[model samples]
Target: MKVSSMDESGKYDKANERLAQVKEEVGKVMVGQEDVIEQVLISILCDGNILLESNPGMGKTKMISTISKVLGLEFSRIQNTPDLMPSDITGTHIVDESADTTDFVFQKGPIFANMILADEINRATPKTQSALLEAMQEKQVTVGNNSYSLDDPFFLMATQNPIEQEGTYPLPEAQRDRFMMKVELDYPSLEEENKIVDRFTSELDFEPELENVISRSSLIRLQEFTRKVPIANDLREKAVNIASATREKEELDYGASPRASMNIVLASKARALIEGRNHVSEKDIKEVAKPVLRHRIGLSFQAEKQGMNEDKIIDQIIEQQ
Candidate 1:
């Protein structure tokens, strides 16, 4: 069913209500970082994973919890530690001779949920990190020759401490590329922080209750709509060119993968839906360029020494359009 043909007024009302519902749900637990929450939701609704890089004490955990609650999805959080093992996240097969002598039962891990918050992902070793990354890419975990697919609306929101370097394992380029967006969650404004303080201190330390306005099936439908959303030939080329500039441009050593193009296209569709548009526009592409493309592009040591940043390179590509 077309977005336009399916009860236009009703769909719009529902969409808007869902948007507001998510915002209100997140706002209840979080004092601010509304934009971060919105972007994270966009990624989730688009069936994509997100990488949120911020310092400590940024309420990343609370935000993920609130979103899971509002969406009525099973939520799981894994505190990624250096000593974390693959079996710890992907589960393992242990023969329980005491309970059942003949059968080996599968012990499920935290990745089995619909919504997963990989808190402090950088703290985990790369081997353990790949366990979650594989699930993010395949949406399934394999153990002892058996595979288990994760539930639908399976979303991973990983948080990292950008400032902390001690005993942290930063995500490599290949792993980073899997994420649809690398969102930066900064400190809230002074007014927002003050409100956070007042609310947390005054309230019972519990977030507001959120109504489940959207369903997992409806979310899947929305993702399908995003795939069907029309993109003009020119806009498609623009997206391609923007991706090409990342690798071919002189400032960078490596370019973004085909995954980046996919992200740009899907994220633009999600943006249009949020803005009540049936078709995607270049404006939507431009809006998502930075967050979608920043981490995908790699800078040379010379460029880094020269203080050239990803945003600057993306700005140049945007100016070309």
Candidate 2:
């Protein structure tokens, strides 16, 4: 495809405008935590999954559900639990009594949707959690003896509550690494909270209605455009350097893999497009570095004894680099 300057600019402008509409629509339902919204948008644009960590009653589910509405994607929610079986999520074969001959028919599960919200994902056992591995990475679900392909532009949004750890299984490192970004949603600001209160308790009934800002096909095209956004050669190395530096730090037991670097650049490009820019910048890389790498690296026991966290370790790496 020969993309001319004008053609590229027009497509980018349309996408930029559409994204602003999406933000506006989501904001009607959600109050504060704009960063969380932005990071989720970037991850979606990059065709990756997001791991959202927060306390209860943060509207994590409400926010993502609203996002799916505006994107015009089929959305499904999975409330993970200890007893939730892999078959429950991926579907299974059922007896086909209607058929002339006795046979079993494969039934599609919630994993077949365009966007899936895995609520309280940590509540599921590792065995059950692993069910999402193939679907998330390869956009395919295997059930019975058959492999089923998921919809195009498949995206997963998973949430976990950090305050409650009991009866919760930690996400395996392999699954953690599959998420492109780990978004943290904090409490609403005072003014934002007041607005939230007013909206819910208004004398006039108020319901947030989100229209589809862009069609599903348009979103896929935007994703292609996001990938085509130019990145400077130097910025690429800096992105890799940020991830590689974590490995050299003796205080950290394990560092991020090369996948971290790839996500950083991909996220940076998405951020640039959101900001109405045609090319990626070093600043874009730095802005997305924290979320892209925070969950990928492991802290040493010594560092844990010293009360060091992943964000702090990531901060040090970015500062020195």
Candidate 3:
């Protein structure tokens, strides 16, 4: 973790090289969303869930699926809908009949995978959404008095459309807090959009063959190394101060919890490792602040009336710190 020795330095360098390869592999299918890809990688390294916000047809699913393949992790997707039941995602027990006897058997659901893409997550009713709560936080599923452990390196990336609100159930505050970071994917730039169109239209079936850049065990080790990334005492304090400032700000009705503070520091460490750095910096904290605090904090009526948003409030807090 220290990387002071030549062997540790070599491992650190190899990790970054493989991570860059992962981005390159994902970039083949995904047009241009470097920031989005990096955020997802950071969440994975931290072993935390992500809440992704974007409009439809933005390749959110493709991005996640492609990354799963490149990282060599098991991928499963759940298309959330109002009628989707808890059993649909978490599986249910069924009666198994044999020649002489019948017994109940436990079946596994899509949540057993290493990476789960919960598409259009807001479309699911609160009851169905709550079903994911235990799995997301505990990495285990409970079915009929039995608990089953999820695979290693498990994380859920849930997506919601920002343009649509009707007939959609907003994620409750508790569920939203379960996500380590809430990432907003904007529309691609003109150049990127053109590339996207040309890339898909040119071929009858467009599928970019991507290599497995990192294996499951290596990924697990990298996640452990992410935590070992060092940070200066002052930078660590700065991260805490930024989270604490949210509660003190008058423009917000309620601020982020202590969990937010922990996420900021952990995420910063992950970011530093991703950037091929040995230590965390102020820039790392500032870069991750908005995504870490946006969904956790609420704006006051006055702030909302003034057209102020969570990002703006977060920026002010960072400036103060």
State the TM-score for model 2.
Answer: 0.96
Cα miss at 162, model 2 (Å)? 0.8
Clashes of each: 0, 0, 0
List lDDT for all candidates, in order.
0.84, 0.91, 0.92
Clashing pairs in 2: none
lDDT of 3 by residue, 1-321 (tens): 454687777777887888899999999899899999999999999999999898888989989999999999999999998899999999999888864688889889999999999999999999999999999999999988999999998999998988356778888999988999999999999999999999999999999889999999999999999988888999989998999899999999999998999999999998888898878988999999999999999999999999999999999989887
Error of 3 at 10 (Å): 2.0
All candidates in order of TM-score, best leading: 3, 2, 1
Worst 10 residues of 2 by lDDT: 200-209
Return the candidate ranking by lDDT, descending: 3, 2, 1
lDDT-better candidate, 1 vs 3? 3
Task: Flag regions of model 2 displaced more than 4 Å.
Answer: 1-4, 203-206
TM-score of 1: 0.93
lDDT of 2 by residue, 125-159 (tens): 99999999999899999886789999998999999
Check candidate 3 and list the clashing pairs: none
Candidate with top TM-score is: 3
Q: All predictions: root-mean-square deviation over Cα?
A: 2.2, 2.0, 1.6
